[model samples]
Target: MTSMRALGRDRCLQLLASVPVGRVVFSMRALPAIRPVNHLVDGNTVVIRSNLGGALASTATQSGAVVVAYEADTFDLDGHTGWTVVVTGTARLILDADRQARYERLLHPWVDEPMNCVIGIDCDLVTGYELAPA
Candidate 1:
């Protein structure tokens, strides 16, 4: 049997901040798409930097904002003990140059691509669960 423990909102954000990489789920061409990207946790948001004119940027550029679900998790293979966190929010492009600069400095892109666009996702709904053997 397996048991699940709910994590507090504050603790969920703490876990999110501890990780640098996460999967962002969005809609592309009416289909669900998942992209693994590196992100930084701002006060109440997640910041991701990508190519200014890339496909990922268009998701937020074309529309004022896009609904997305971001997730980060880790589990012990042998122990079957781990935690998973999911955050659902609206992702919007940060057009302000000043704020973009600040986010860029905080979230460095891992890929060797010219990342000039910033996407900020508000961590409005945070849910996390710890899975362990019962």
Candidate 2:
């Protein structure tokens, strides 16, 4: 087993931005739930779109904070190398018109429902790790 290397904030953000998909973690009724979501990285914020339901929509609408994690790396059983990145912060609904437009242009929800909501996570804490063959 290899030791995990601590990744800087910049590196974490970079990895998150480069990855096209991530998992959004939030608490629902004191229980933690994680769901796969499409995200758009805008500076220090991570933007994601959702329909009218689900934990993310409900959580964001209720003014709740969440932790979004994005990881990108190759994994193999033959001692391959890879990396993982995690981001934790406060999440809220995006209400700004300009910001909404920008995020809308960048992200398109896969569902057929009307995607009139945008949730953004203020990346307050970010960390990552890399695994490589010795």
Candidate 3:
């Protein structure tokens, strides 16, 4: 086991910038669900693209934005060296067409489907840690 130190908000965001893919945790059908997604960090916001009618997109479009947790990690199983970052915040659908387009250009998803639905999560509570043997 190794001791972990807390990472500051700035450091967390910086680490996140280097990460291209993350897991988005949200609620669907009254149950918690998580999906692997590609994202782009725009300032303090994390943006993701999804199908317009998908569960993720629908949650963002609902009233009173959805509370989401975005997590990304890099680690080596043999060495156990890396960092894990988790961000919890409100997520909403990007209503502005121009802004949506900008996000789409910045984030490239693996899926071939059209990423017309843009969801942005405000990095309100950024928490991260580096894992290394003491």
Candidate 4:
């Protein structure tokens, strides 16, 4: 049997930083869209690099700070042990040159494309669950 437990905010953030990739859920054309991107946890924020022409970047730039959910997880099917984290927050483009440059150095794109945009999601409420052996 397996058991599940709730993870606190700080613990959730730590788990997020341990992972390399996650899904960023945002709105496009009034519809929900999800993009898989690698990220870095900065303090209590999640940062991702994206192409300037991408839908995410476009939406973020046009809307300023947008509400979104960032989710990431890892699990072992055989063992039924792992954790899932979902973060609800506001995302905004890092437009300042210095900050953008700093993020550019800290984050690397997984795809072979130019990622000219750096967005930060300030975590407002972080909820997570961990499954483990009972």
Candidate 5:
């Protein structure tokens, strides 16, 4: 039997901050879609940048509630030990000038068009799991 482990907020934040890339999940027309994104943890929120196109941008603009999942795992065939961290939370578009500026400093846009938009997810409800050699 395999046992599941529950991770605390501190662990979740630590894992999220350590990784530079994650997957953002959202629904488009009742269909689930996942996109890879580069994010940064700002205090209790995760900030990411994107261009004007894409389902993520459209969903955020439509004021749709989205669940952004940031996950990371490590595994070795010989060691048979690894861990995974997952963070799920509501997502929204960042429009405030001050907040946008701060997020911009923390998350640099890698794409063209200056990444005229930003998406943020508050880490109000975050959970994770880990499996390692005991």
Candidate 6:
């Protein structure tokens, strides 16, 4: 048997910080769109690098702040044990040149294309669960 345990905010954020990649859920053409991307946890926020021309960046810029969800997880399929985390919050483009430059240095995109924009998602609600052997 297996048991599921709920994780607290602190632990959830910690687990999120431990992972390098996650899926960001956002609105695209009035529909939910998800994209897998690399990220970094900065304080209570998750930061991702994207091209200025990308939908995510453009949406955030146009709306100032967009509600979004971020999910990341790791699982041991054989053992059925691992952790999953989801964060809901507002995503905004980091407008400060210095901060944007700092984030660019801290997070490198997976692709070779130019990623000139940095988006920060301020975590408002964090929920997580851990599955373990009973």
Task: Indicate which candidate wins on lDDT.
Answer: 6
TM-score of each: 0.94, 0.85, 0.94, 0.95, 0.83, 0.96
Candidate 5 residue lDDT tens string, 13-120: 888888788777767888877877788888888888988677788777876556666555555657665556667778888889999888888787655565878888
Report the lDDT tens digits of candidate 3 across residue range 1-134. Answer: 77688899999988888988999999899999999998888899998888988888876776659899999999988887889999999998888989987887778889998778888899999999988888
Q: Encode model 4's per-residue lDDT on 13-131: one tens digit a residue.
A: 99999999999998899898999999999998899999999998888888788898999999999998999999999999988999899999889898999899999999999999999
lDDT string for model 1 (72-91, tens) is: 98888888898999999999
Stretch of 10 with least lDDT, candidate 6: 54-63
- Looking at candidate 1, what is the lDDT of residue 67? 90
Task: Compose the digit string of candidate 6's lDDT tens values, residues 1-134.
Answer: 77999999999999999999999999899998999999999899999988999989999988899999999999999999999999999999999999988998889999999998899999999999999998
Native RMSD of candidate 6 (Å): 1.0
Select the stronger candidate by lDDT from 3 and 5: 3
The TM-score of predicted model 3 comes to: 0.94
Tens-digit lDDT string for candidate 2 (36-134): 778878888888887757767776677655555443443565775567777778887788899889889989987677878888888887878877655
Residue 100, candidate 2: Cα error in Å is 0.8
The full ranking of all candidates by lDDT, starting with the best, is 6, 4, 3, 1, 2, 5
User: Looking at candidate 3, what is the lDDT of residue 25?
Assistant: 96
TM-score of candidate 4 on Cα atoms, chains taken together: 0.95
- Of candidates 6 and 5, the better by TM-score: 6
Off by over 4 Å in 1: none
Note the residue pairs that clash in candidate 3: none
Give the Cα RMSD of candidate 4. 1.0
Better of 3 and 6 by TM-score: 6
Once model 3 is optimally superposed onto the true structure by TM-score, how far is the C-alpha of residue 127 displaced, in angstroms? 0.6
